[model samples]
Target: MYANTPRTTATRHRDRMSYDRDLVHSVLDEAWVCHLSFVVDGEPRVLPTLHVRIGDVLYVHGSTGSRPLRSAQPDGIKVSVAVTLLDGLVLARSQFHHSANYRSVVAHGTATVVTDPAEKSAVLTAIAEKIAVGRAADTRPPTPKELAQTSVLALPLVEVAAKMRTGGVSDDPEDYALPHWAGVLPLRVVAGDPEPDKGVEGVPDYLRAVIGVTG
Candidate 1:
């Protein structure tokens, strides 16, 4: 479990905050995109990009020319990254009590550009595999030229906390008697049928498993 420091402590909705490393990892791993917030010349900027977690480090990548990638230099850049997954929409008798069930993680740290060739390659592979379980092995590895054009930043999962809300709606006893529909509308990501290119043949086994297509 990660120890909560002043910066990591929850100031609001304290009951929803979690310091469990596994919880934090699950939330991060399940998310396809993460919002990265950082300052550039005293101005704030936020960019949404792909991310993958390998052990205790979170890796995000973009073109070498991207502003955020360029800013994370030798000394590293201070950043706040967030990942969230919405589970359901909570409907209450009263609008005031309405809320959504979600799992989220916010991390604060210095993000530094990954320079090692092997590590950079591995990270890129992990990001690809995150999209489809066994994709990295099926696709060609990035060439030296391709690797040079991409920039990856690594942020340690130190100052991180996961916040979540689950279960049914919570309404005042009086509000429950109101004449209105009240219940949770469950939400989840469902994988659609795989569409292959014109020249390609049958779906790969890995992809079939991902979308739950059985013979």
Candidate 2:
């Protein structure tokens, strides 16, 4: 079955949209950042931030005073979240036919601040691991003061939609005879060389694993 109402129907490109649980979860899991849209005082704002998914919940952390997080508190607040991973560029012979090959996920839902310190801390660990495999254990835990200023908000994995496009250029039949060349340009994210700090003894094993480096 499909997800909630808002995600069930696609006004455009219905064939490219899906509500499959596995597809939605995979998109969210593979994405490192998301654009969250929330309204405050009759105005809408979107902010890009890091997030991590644990089971059916997605957690985003930031300062307690942040506008978006503050608005999403005990009372709960509805927001829109979008995550996209651009895989390639479809270069058609004609400009109008140029398109992008990408996987995107969108969802509308309520988000709320996580009040339980223990749960919040645990969420932080999961988020850290998402950034770098074993990053959570390598750094100092959040202190009381730090935790006080921080806010970890959660959004349920409901009302979600995943849309994706993949293939070569979709050129017009007439364009096939044209001299212009057309093809797909594939792209992907990659890790950069490790930059060790002066005080650090050496690169940690976790860093090595993430960067494909060995000491």
Candidate 3:
């Protein structure tokens, strides 16, 4: 267990919650997007964007002028970032027992805009690799102008929590006799055939490996 501060503790369904760093990183790594929440002008704002976890730090990027990106600073600007992956839908005998099988991680920390040139460039590369393993190497590197136009925020994985629920529906004991269907409708993210670019050549082995496994 680690980073289990009061801010990361759950008030309900505590049994489903965890303070484990491994669990947090697993959920974060599998997620494609994260919802970053922060206060802007006295209003709570949540923005869905690309995020990557390199070691214990989470990096999110955006247009330099965007409110969330611009407002982030080294000063204490409290923020929370969360990633959720739904595994299945639980269909219960009764409506009240409905639920979802999901894995989620919520992290609370201060948001700071990354300024160091080397670190900033590395983070951008990491973000690209997160999207696709071989993508960063396949594409041309960003220019100085491109880097200047973007802003990246680094959120430390200090106070974090992970929650998950799996398995079948839980209904009242008496409702078990009901003639309604009760089972889990499993879900997954699968990949289809690769869409090649104009006049592209052979499919990269790394990408082919991904599609082969997912397919």
Candidate 4:
């Protein structure tokens, strides 16, 4: 078992906290979006973007003209990223006891621009394939101009923590007999039907497999 990495003065911590690298990676791999928080001009800004995980590294991309991409210069970029997945809603007998059962990972690290064309291409492929498994195989590779206009940043999974809350609501002992209904309202991400582009001729097998639909 991996030991939980301790939270420092700057780290956020509460009851039932975890910081194991494996646990953090597991939560990150399951989610497609991440809130990347960073300091810009002495103010904190959070950017929500799609992300992909490769081993211990987290990759986030944007156009070269994007603010976040421009701000991440060679001097390095310090950032805190959060990925959360809500599993269910806990309904307690008392209104004050309501809470959400979730799995979340918060990571802090410095990001470096991926400049090498070969490596950048590979990372881009990983990003596409992650969004739709096997998509990279059918999609055309980025053109030279496209690659030059895009910016990819790699953030090593350094200091990180994963916190999770599960099970039913915790109500006061006396509230159990209050005659109020209590249970968990589950949440999930269900795949929707895949819609092809207006000019596209046929749906690709990978897209079909991604949405579990037959065209």
Candidate 5:
């Protein structure tokens, strides 16, 4: 649990909410893209990328020719990864009271390359499946040359914090009488109809099971 882990300067308090590890992992699992931040050449860089969570390990991929991937080789990689989901827009009578309702997770950890071929292949499959469940089995596996041209890194979720704000708008007591409505406009992510690519003979049962639908 996050409460069991010591809160340092980096992992200290979140003003709005208290979170356990389960809440944090749940938020991460629901999100597809994460922003990865690290220091390179004494300058900070943040990259938005797709990632997959397998247990406590988070996997990120890049081309073998990437500069940041090359820089991660010699020195240990210190990174901060974050994901945020906006749930609603909070409208209040006072401008100061305006805010957003969101759930977010921040994790600080060290990243290292996955060197084993078998493990690398499995991680790649997990990544593909995450994009669209069961897509990995339908597509051709990566060739030897393609495997050699890709880079994968694993970052353990050692220190993490989740913060969230929900419910209706909060307005100042004095401003509540002002001529403005206050409430939350909810939002959500819904999947659209699945479209097959050209030359596809038919969708398989494994894919149907993965998507929880049948045509």
Candidate 6:
């Protein structure tokens, strides 16, 4: 369980906030993209990137020359990261009550450079597997030159909280009888049929499984 720090505590809709460690992990795992925000030269910067979780640590990789990666040099830099997955669109009878159903996690911590070769390799493998099961085994491992060009940063999940809104619409009792459609429009990320490259012949079973396609 994660202690609710002042930073992680919600200032609004507190009921939707969760401190459960499992909930946090699930939210992070389900969401492929994360928005990483940090300060560079006294200016705030945020960018979307892919992230993978290993235990309590969240790892993000990018070119070695990237601003954020370079900032986490010898000493780590403070950063805020957020991952959100939209579940549905709530359409209330009244416009004011309309909102989105989503699961999101916000974490605050220091983003430190991952320098260990073994750990870096594991992080890379985990990222590939996250994108598609068995992908790491199917593709060639990153060469030494490639590894030298990429940089990875690790953020520990210490001060983190998950906030989510689920279920149908929440409209005023008086507006319930209004002449308007009011309900949740469920949303999800669906994978489409894989289109292999010209030389590629067949789709891997593992890839099909990842996308929920049965034989």
TM-score per candidate: 0.94, 0.90, 0.91, 0.87, 0.82, 0.94
What are the per-residue Cα lDDT tens digits for candidate 2 across 1-215?
34547545778888998888888888888888888888878998788887778888888764534565775668788878899999999999999999999999887888888888777778878877876788988888987676766677788887788889998888889998889989999988777667888886777777767663211
lDDT of each: 0.87, 0.80, 0.81, 0.78, 0.74, 0.85
lDDT, candidate 6, residue 106?
95
- Scored against the true structure, residue 59 in model 2 reaches a CA lDDT of 80
lDDT of 3 by residue, 39-83 (tens): 878889788887888999988764434565686566846788989
| Model 5 CA lDDT for position 150 | 66
State the lDDT of candidate 5 residue by residue for 52-101, as single tens digits.
Answer: 78888877764434587655874448888888888889988888888888
| By TM-score: ranked, best first | 1, 6, 3, 2, 4, 5
Candidate 2 global lDDT: 0.80
Ranking by lDDT: 1, 6, 3, 2, 4, 5
Model with the higher lDDT, candidate 4 or 6: 6
lDDT of 6 by residue, 58-85 (tens): 9876553466567567689898999999
Off by over 4 Å in 1: 212-215
lDDT of 4 by residue, 143-180 (tens): 88878766877888777778899888899999989989
Predicted structure 4: clash tally: 0
Clashing pairs in 4: none
> Could you tell which candidate, 4 or 6, scores higher by TM-score?
6
Question: What is the clash tally of candidate 2?
Answer: 0
- How far is 172's C-alpha from truth in model 4 (Å)? 1.3
Question: In model 5, which regions exceed 4 Å deviation?
Answer: 3-19, 64-66, 201-215
Q: How does residue 2 of candidate 4 score in lDDT?
A: 30
Q: Is candidate 3 or candidate 4 better by TM-score?
A: 3
